[model samples]
Target chain A: MSASDVTRAIRRMAHEILERNFGCVDVVIVGLQTGGVGLAERLVDDINEIEGTEVPLGSLDATMHRDDFDLRPITSEAATTIPVDPTGKIIVLVDDVLYTGRTVRAALDAIHSYGRPKAIQLAVMVDRGHRELPIRPDFVGKNLPTRRAEMVDVNNDGVDLGEIS
Target chain B: MKALRHLLSMDDLDRDDIEYLLDLTERYVEVSERKIPRIPALRGKTVALVFFEDSTRTRVSFATAAGRLSADTLGFDVGRSSVNKGESLRDTIETISAMGIHCIVLRHFGAGAPWRVREWTDASIVNGGDGRNQHPTQSLADLFTARQHLGDLDGRRIAIVGDIKNSRVARSNAIGFSKMGAEVIFVAPRTLLPASLEGWPVKVTHNLDEVIESIDVCYLLRMQLERQNDAAVPTLREFHHEFGLTTARADRLRDDALIMHPGPMNRDVEIAGVVADRPNAVITEQVSNGVAVRMAVLFVLIGSRLDLVEEQSAVA
Candidate 1:
């Protein structure tokens, strides 16, 4: 996937979100920390550009809520800023890549500490299939099936699938 | 990055580690600001608060930090525990570790208790003031509070006043501040000052009034009356008159200079009542930051272990 591919995917995702949510009323977009933050911000901008209406933006860090905490390196924490009350609001969780589905699960657990939202919807720039858990993204930009050893890198340059080595 | 297993002393951390922990503390500070001031960081993890000494602030601070992180905290009651039955410290620590405790926040009258406990158990040891050895977390909180008011610690002049010989807070703060590039000045009467400033990287002074004008922070240490001998001071009145942070001395300090104390303060003895409660006084903020700092420490130790375990399992 190229940079233009990512841009087009983001625009499509934004339009899909607006169309499905029925014009963005009470809709909130939250980017996962680190990778998802930039993508979420861009998605919010795209949504605003398309609808000419403002939507609430937030960033959630799922480091502490991770299930694989005891097996990995110490995860660095990022700021979780939910500017508006998530209660009774539609929460659209945005992320860069959906791999193990563990991170999204962690994000779901982390969000409860904030407030119980009416609904939470997951949006990913790319869904590389190799899930260890029974989790799925509500909105996916691209669904790329890959081996377990493969890595997906998503950024301004767009998404690249390559071997870990 | 390499994970810190035990925080036995301020010496165990470098400038980078201190800065990292302080930065990590900002996240917890944000968590604390939320309507629900709790996180699932340490959920399902157990932490033991093993205090052989009586401490209201540090003990409560660690407990609150663990609770906010959602960790199960077991406050070891030295009063009722097997210590009363003459069980050894080593045995007690091993027994607790055997029960699957993840971390131990220890406070003991004997210096190096945490360091020794580390040899006995794999549980990460956090020194919550070991005798007169070191209170690394208190220093971390002090640094956090100082940074809150003073902005940056680099080249900041900090005068650690009062009982230097018996103050673990002073010892830890001296090492921590200097490591962070702060100029540390030890202020005390001749008797109260350490016999030798030999190895420590700090300027020793007998007069607080002279340096009060130049200092960025007047960090007053409690005059440990219980630890002091008759020769340590002529009298409490004379000590307060000469070395204490009296109103007159406080008047000489810079307007922006911060007044700090590791409580509970002996109001009239080490610092004037008015000085302690003044707007520039950040003693309360230090107490509040204490929880955040400890939470950061706990997360780094226990959280890292959890991560490492999961990583190994994934590899397997």
Candidate 2:
């Protein structure tokens, strides 16, 4: 996927989110740290520009809520910051890629700690299916099917599918 | 993540290590503020609290930190345990290690007990408080609290006032603050001052008035009623007049100067009761930050994955 394709997908996703939610009432956009932060910012910016309404933006690092901590170290470099209380609000969780579904699951666990949201919808730039958990994204930028051993890279440049080694 | 086998002293950490741990401490602080203030960072790991001495805050703090990380904590009570039956420290440590624990948070009246215990157990050893030696986590908490109020401790002035000779907090914090580029000043009477200050990176002053108004932090040490038996001063009243953060002395402090105490404070002896209630006094914050700091320390030291850079020995 090219940079222009990623921007176009974000613009379309912003439109779909408003249309699905029926006019974007009490909508809060939270981007996962590192990868999804830029995408979420762009998504919120596009949504606000299109709807002519301001939306709250926040970022979360779901490292602490990870279920496989017994298998890896907890790196808490980036802090989780939610500007407003999420109680009874529609939270649009944005991420760069949807793979394994573990990160999204951990992010769900993390968001519940702050407050009970009215609902949560997942947005992803790329959906590379290899889910170990029953989780799905509500919005997707690109659908790239690959082998289990392949790696999907998402950045400002583009999305590249390649082997890690 | 930094590989650490044992956290025995403030000397074990460098400037970068302290900053890394304190930065992680900030993240833990955020975790603690949520509706559910617990995380499963160290699930299935066991942290044994092998405290050979009596304590209130340090013991509770470490146990709470381990629990927040979803690790099991087994507190070995000295009074009720085999210590009464004359079992050796080594024997106690071996017994705990045989059960396969991940860490041991120890507080013993003997100064070098954690080092000796580290030899007995494969688990990481954390010095909760080892005699008059060092309380690394307490100092870490102090640094974290200081950083919360002040940005970086690069040029801050800290006046550790009280019985410096008997304070593990003072000893550890002097090294810690200095490592962070803070100037440390020890204020105490002649009898309460340590015998040697040649190796320490601090300036010694017998009078609190000399640096009271100039310091960025006024750290008051709890009068060690149990440890100070040397007739350090004429009376408690005299000590209060001379060095205690009396209302007058508190008023003399800089408006932004932070007043701190390690805990179980002697309200009238070291710090006045009214003065402690002042906004500048972050005594409560110090105590609360203790949990977060210990959480960061424990998670960084032992809760790391097996594939990371695993190294032995502390006090680098």
* Each model's lDDT: 0.90, 0.90
DockQ of each: 0.52, 0.60
The TM-score between candidate 1 and the true structure equals 0.93
Who wins the TM-score comparison?
A: 2
- Across residues B1-316, which tens digit of lDDT does each residue of candidate 2 receive? 4567889999999998899899999998988898878877888889999888899999999999998888899989899999899999999999999999999999999998898898888899999999999999999999999999999899899999998899999999999999999999999998998889899999999999999889999999988989867798899999999989999989999899999999899889999999999999999999999999999898887876533434222312
Supply the global lDDT for candidate 2: 0.90
**Each candidate: fraction of true contacts kept?**
0.70, 0.66
Candidate 1 ranges beyond 4 A from true positions: B306-316
CA displacement after TM-score superposition, residue A147 of candidate 1 (Å): 2.4
Give model 1's DockQ, 2 decimals: 0.52
Q: What would the per-residue lDDT of candidate 1 be over residues B1-316, giving only the tens digit for each residue?
A: 3467889899999998888889889889988876788878888999999989888999999999999999999999799899999999999999999999999999999998887899999888999999888999999999989988888899999999999999999999999999999999999988877677789989998988779899999999999988876678888898899989999999888999999999999999999998898899999999999999999999988875645645666788
lDDT digits (tens) for residues A1-165 of candidate 2: 999998899999999999989978989999998789999999999999998988999999988778877665555558788988999999999999899999999899889988999999999999999899999999999999989889999988889999967
Q: Return the clash pairs for model 2, or none.
A: B12-B315
